[model samples]
Target: MNAGFDVAVVGSGIVGLGAALAAHRRGLRVVVIERGSEASGASVRNFGHLCFTPQAGLARDFALTSRELWLGLALDAGVWLRESGTLVAARRDDEFAVLRDLAATRGVEVELLTAAEAEARMPLAPGTAVGGAFLPRDLQANPRQAVAALAAHLEREGVEFRRRTTVGAVRPGRVETSRGPIDVGRVIVAVNHDIDLLYPEVAERHGIVRCSLDMMRVAAELRMPLAAPLLTGWSLVRYGAFSATPAAAALRERLHSERPDLAALDLNQMYTRLPDGTLIVGDTHSRGATVAPFQAEFAFESMLDETRVLFGVDALRVVERWQGVYASGPDDFLIEEVEPGVHLASATTGIGMTTGLGLAEHVVAAFSDDVTTTADEPGFASAPTTTLQKGAS
Candidate 1:
């Protein structure tokens, strides 16, 4: 029972794994305890689109830090990553206005593309795009592979993983798991939406709840391969940076008035093509204390209809479909030390893959004196003792 670990992380998702990696790099003995046999949560059930360029405030800070960590993982851990910047296809002038406003603010980070240029870059139906913008700094990864590879790489670096072990309680210096008691210097809870189960008070205080989304993979014949992760006007109104633009209000109002059905679904219509050429399409949002297990078929049909209209393709063979759930809150993240020696870290939105690593690193660095932050790693500074407040990434 006495594992002699310096840090014990709960959950094996990206944030948990990132915590273990950060602690291990600081020469601390780390143990990860997961209730599942493997990581089968939101970590793997996402688009793997590192759309950090559209983030604002603290989320943007974490995103910049995550970019470096992701690039390092690609070289060190062999996690497959691409520098494929995000491509936003604007179907309406209002959407283009939002992108243009963002481009004005971000300069080189946001590159405005003409209608012809946008069509040339992506396999969109010719002339479908009035204009668009390319986020040159954003990246992409295979969600199915990145977390597993990172976990495996951590295991090779002397971190121990206790899979199928349920953690019942955590206190100042001890964690009570189903296996037994573990003595550790620190405890990090990164269980995403399940934090409610472990620490109801913390979840309640932050207004944390589950946000479920439906996503699918399909094999489709395109005019050409998807050059990068694609975002539609729906996406422009969802991400923080774009939504904060003055032009976003008109865009949102117009879209909602035009397509009440899609707006009813709370869609963030986006797509990312996997390395094998299968396109990952998603998704629709529904938030509650607990989401329904049943997914509506109409959601899938709507996605298919949108996909066909966007790409001008007739048929798409369905490969798979599933639901992805993540922590949702009023603010962008939930980083707190609810009790002495016990910390909570979670991305309270869909950008966990984009910002989770940096969030984890920031939390660990806050309390651990051994964590070294180089000059190049900006925004890795220790978090304030107060709660972090910002909009969604």
Candidate 2:
């Protein structure tokens, strides 16, 4: 107990922090080792939107569950969450129908609106198109703030985080970091592409890779209208670029037929209003193994063009340009005991906000050798409350 840690987790990203929290809650002596000063990876990058809808199957469930946990954290840790609801504007009739179907699904409640109806609610400047579905449960937060707060909370729980420290080797019941060698009952690798950096054998056990793409944040508006996030038909079409299912394929075809301009633009994007009126828009492309470090300016521009065509916006001030790196390893959640004392987990399909907590719980249960005490609440665990107050992280 005085010598090393019960579990050593590599990577200080969202997943790593979630894992540390889960392990700590289960009463395991946990330590987190990060290669960055803060969460200097994809965890803190991109729009800090904890997406609520347009999610299906497992990711949707995990997202809902993570949101529940976030509510508790907001109450306890004072993490900020803007409770503005999401609106899916249906420029065309078919799109409106699709949203209707989405709402019809059990456990999903969506509010429909007409052009006049939506304008009154959203205050869209009269010509902001028409027809949309409003779901009030969607929420957004500052990713950096949330991560920092989580790190602090874990520290208070005696969970140690060694920022800028690298793991040299992973052996069963121990981890060798640049800081020093520490023995442990279990080791968890939460790093995405660089996971192999600590344990080369992890490459054979699990595919570790990066996802490169463009992200844009302008300095126009300083405040967001509502606390929720936004996505458009561009997303449904682009979802096909990543998935090959029949529904996805049909959706792609529909997008091509109804909105050929979107297909031509190569734009699969989701947009959210920043707190100040500037917008946060993104993203496309999912590289399975190794994502490149290039920004497709044309793709970004196309996203803007699609933005104009969809929302009919003339222009907004452009300030920030960004790139996001993500990890994915099929539908399977990653967790591998590489050797006697080494464990590996990464490539989580860009669902960090959704599945991180569930994954955390799973990791904790496994690490404790099946000793567990986590039960799901009736509805969602986290609900939209007041604006989250800014705290330490």
The C-alpha RMSD in Å for every predicted model, in order, reads 2.2, 6.5
Candidate 1 per-residue lDDT, tens place, 286-357, comes to 999998999999999999999999999998999999999999999988888988989998999989999898
Backbone clashes in candidate 2 total 26
Q: State each candidate's clash count.
A: 0, 26
Candidate 1, which ten residues in sequence have the lowest lDDT sum? Answer: 377-386
Each model's lDDT comes to: 0.90, 0.63
| Candidate 2 Cα misplacement greater than 4 A, ranges | 123-130, 196-208, 220-227, 237-249, 257-266, 286-288, 340-342, 369-393
Best by lDDT: 1
lDDT of 2 by residue, 1-393 (tens): 226777888888777887787677667788888877888777777677665565555455555667776776776666776776676666555556566666666677678888777655553445664576777776777776888887887788688878887777777766777777877777778886676566556554555566666778754322225335665655544321223223444555777887565465445567766656667777765564556676756777777766555554566556677777776545435555667556565535665664566555555555465343446522123212222121110
Overall local distance difference test of candidate 2? 0.63
Model 2: ten consecutive residues of lowest lDDT? 384-393
